[model samples]
Target: MKALRVEKPNNISVVEIPKVRLEKDNEILIKVKAAGICGSDISIYSGQSPVATYPRILGHEVTGIVEEISKSVTKFKVGDHVIIKQTESCNNCYACKHGRDNVCVDLKVRGVNIDGGYCEYITVPETSAYKIPKDLDFKTAVLIEPFTIAFQACSRGRLQKDDTLLVYGAGALGATVIQVAKSFGCKIIAVDIEEEKLIQAKNLGATYAINGKSPTLKEEIQAASENYGPTICIDSVCNPKSFEFLVDIVGNAGRVVLMGFDTRVSEIPQFKITARELDIIGSRLQHDKFEKVIDLFARDIIQPKDMISHVFHFEDIEKAFDVIASKQFRKIVLTF
Candidate 1:
């Protein structure tokens, strides 16, 4: 089987390796059809990702065809179009037992902690793969993974129909969370420095788009939220400064979802946390959100096509990364 792997930091190539097969009764073999290049993939390629291991097969935003399945795989079969979750966890872990397996103590994440789908074929437990609409485009199908990320964050935030959400960063995940929150009947205020992305956010159901560089950003957010301030804030920008800004901007008793892994020391005032009694949440990969996202995609409630800005063949992975570096796209999907 031909697969793409990073031999080490700053070194990557496609190599022939043994074809994977189903070895468990509940397992299925997926023939890779498309995978999305995420920011983590770039970090891994550049030796900047803290969690990725070397000699890794790099792809997590994935969708593929089930070319083979064990007899016990009653939920799927050969020729089924499917999207697979990227993480596998030990069922006995404290987090897993508490339904927070996305952060299991012994969590193994594909593309970060283990081999992932960057090849002609891969195998996964049947439970991890969910069937997509048979006619769905693979490029769009790959977005389900990211939608899960957005969905998981909203879930963690405990967003309600009456809540007003303030989303930092109007890129792929930002646009997605806006859509997801909109589905819950929540109003959204999307903030970003790029005017184009702000416009895109408005198109994706954000009630307001404020320039992140606006001199009166807080005032604008207050107006957008009808003076109550946003009840939920998500820091998709994922930085210490952004975290502090959200803590200060969100409404009293609001929920703040943290989405970054930066280890920098952030000086957060304990007074704000105590005075407002805010709910601070740390969201990781996802916790069983694939099912919800897949249902949303199948029902046409959300458009995955809106999130994709570029598509490249699998062989042009290098060119794809170059395009990313040049900053000319929103999201890039790689075709097999």
Candidate 2:
């Protein structure tokens, strides 16, 4: 089997490796079809993903075909087309007992803490596999994981049709939020430093797209809100200070969700939040909605293909990492 291996920070290589076999009776083997390069993949490559384990195979947004299923596996069998759920948690942990599996005590992730799908094949727990619509292409199926993340975040804030929403960053997640918010009939203001991304957000259904680089961003958001402010603000960039501005841009009693992965500590306007009775939430990844996102894709409700702007081959994995590190594309897909 050929796999892309990350041996250390700033080092990655494609090499022939031993194929993986199901080590558990509840496990299944999958033949990799297509895997998407995500922003976190770049972080892991540059040694920024905090929980990464070295000598790991780095790809989680994946779609594949089941080649073999363990005797104990019942929901799937040979030749089932599947998209993977990358989260790993101890089902007996305290969080799991409380139905908070995302914060499981012993969490492991594909392509970071464990071997992932950037290979010819991968062995995963049967619980992590979700069957996709047979008619859907592999490339589109890989997007379900991230789309589930977006859905989880939106749901945590209790997104409502009557509220105004502001989402920061125009990356794939940011763009998806715009479409999702619109689906609920919510007015959205999309913010980004990149003009192209803001344009993409608008095309995806953002009511107002503001380029943060523009001097008039605050004014524009205010104008779009009819002199009020957004009722819900989401920071997809995860920068604390950037999130502070998102918090500031919300109306009294509004909610703010931090969806980005910023590690820096910065000052936030605590006084404002305290006085306004606003809610601040930190959302994790896909919970139990993995199948729902697949249904959305199968039904053509949210087409993530529009965000797929780049594709890389197996032999060009390094080149793919280069482009990802440069932050040059909206989304990049890797074909095995």
lDDT of 1: 0.90
Please give, for residues 1-336, the per-residue lDDT of candidate 1 as tens digits. 988899998888888999998899999999999999888888998899998888999999889999999879899978999988989999998899999999998889999879988898989999888999988998899998988999999999999999999999987678888888888988899999999999989988998999999999999999999888899999999898999999989999999999899999777988999998999999998998998988888888898786688888888888987898898887899888
- After superposition, the stretches of candidate 1 with alpha carbons farther than 4 Å from their true spots are none
TM-scores of all models? 0.97, 0.93
lDDT of 2 by residue, 125-152 (tens): 8988999988988987888888888888
Candidates in order have lDDT scores of 0.90, 0.85
Minimum summed lDDT over a 10-residue window in model 1 is located at 303-312
Q: What is the Cα-based TM-score of model 2?
A: 0.93
Q: Which predicted model would earn the best lDDT?
A: 1
At residue 86, what lDDT does model 2 achieve? Answer: 81
